[model samples]
Target: MDLEFMEAHLPLYIEAAVLTLRIAAAGILLAFLTGLITSIIKYLKIPVLMQIVNAYIELSRNTPLLIQLFFLYFGLPKLGVVLSSESCAIIGLAFLGGSYMSEAFRSGLDNVAEIQTQSGLSLGFTRSQIFRHITLPQAVSTSVPLFCANIIFLIKETSVFSAVALADLMFVAKDLIGIYYKTDEALFMLVSAYLVILLPISVIASFVERKVRYAGFGDTSTVSG
Candidate 1:
């Protein structure tokens, strides 16, 4: 590996990583909100809206992020709706990630038994109160691992942002490789940068999963009648 070349390009990778993280963070947040809302709608079975949500979930999950980004950055301009590269990247990530997140949240919400809701109703808990107090907490706790996995998945998906002309980590690495023939160094830095970014998150996700499991959040038996 070219240590000198790697050192010189470190700042470039760092800057790219920052951009990648910013885009990922924004996208992931939007995705989480979208997923939560959709999952809740699905859980509540809101008639017409439920069908719309189902269609959206199917479309988003079935499509690839690169195609989504292409349409956002390239295709929309034909209709005079233009967005910056960053906007396209963020929106594309959110659109793709939202479907996965919805599935994760829906699974968690499904794990919540009907008897729990019945119990809450018998105890004079309002529907909103039951969802807020009993359902949301346990659902979230059960979904923590899935949530973390989705977050990491969204972060990795940021690699494709370069297709939209965003200067993300993958873009920088590929740029360096093409311009300077520093494939080995550029790839090494890319791998190292991702490892640096994802390792801690993986560790924390494992820890949180273990904690949630230990806390009996996923165990309905722990809830007293």
Candidate 2:
């Protein structure tokens, strides 16, 4: 173990850590939005669209991520789906996140009472209006915290982008190991980098979950619990 080399390379590792954070952040945000939309599509069972979204969810969640990256980075361009590595990570993460979010959102929507939609329709609200005013709000509040938990998950998922040679944290760590042969140190640094990116998200998710619980998802009273 070259302590000197490790010390000399700390800055490089930190830079890689920052890049990893950026990648994870971008991917998680995109995934959250995409996932939310797909979840709604599935929950509503929108004719042909719902079935497509269901298939997408199953496919994304069921596949090994390494294969997905290979397909996106190596295979897709065979059919002309070209994207930079970082861009591909965002797209891939969003695709997978959307699929998983659909399941989370469907569960949340199911938690809402069927009567709520009926009452809104009886009050002469259009289907879209009822969804917009009555159904969606409750569904979103119910799902958001859970979705936030998924954000932490999605952040960890971003580490897999190293397969495509994305300079995410994992890639950087592997590079360092290759250079210094301090495999343990490199692996430790990688794990620490992931923790730094993910811990705050978990904490924030917990806070939002508390807020949602207080909002009386069950009560449906004033917006405040």
The candidate that wins on TM-score is 1
Best by lDDT: 1
Report, for every candidate in turn, its global Cα lDDT versus the true structure. Answer: 0.89, 0.76
- In order of appearance, the predictions have TM-scores of 0.94, 0.84
- Per-residue CA lDDT of model 1 for 66-178, tens digit only, reads 99899999999999999999989888988998888999999888777777789899999999999999888878888889999999989988899999888889889899989
- The C-alpha local distance difference test score for the whole of candidate 1 amounts to 0.89
Q: Please give the distance, in angstroms, between residue 75's alpha carbon in candidate 1 and its true position after superposition.
A: 0.3
Instruction: Tell me the lDDT of candidate 2.
Output: 0.76
Looking at candidate 2, what is the lDDT of residue 41?
73
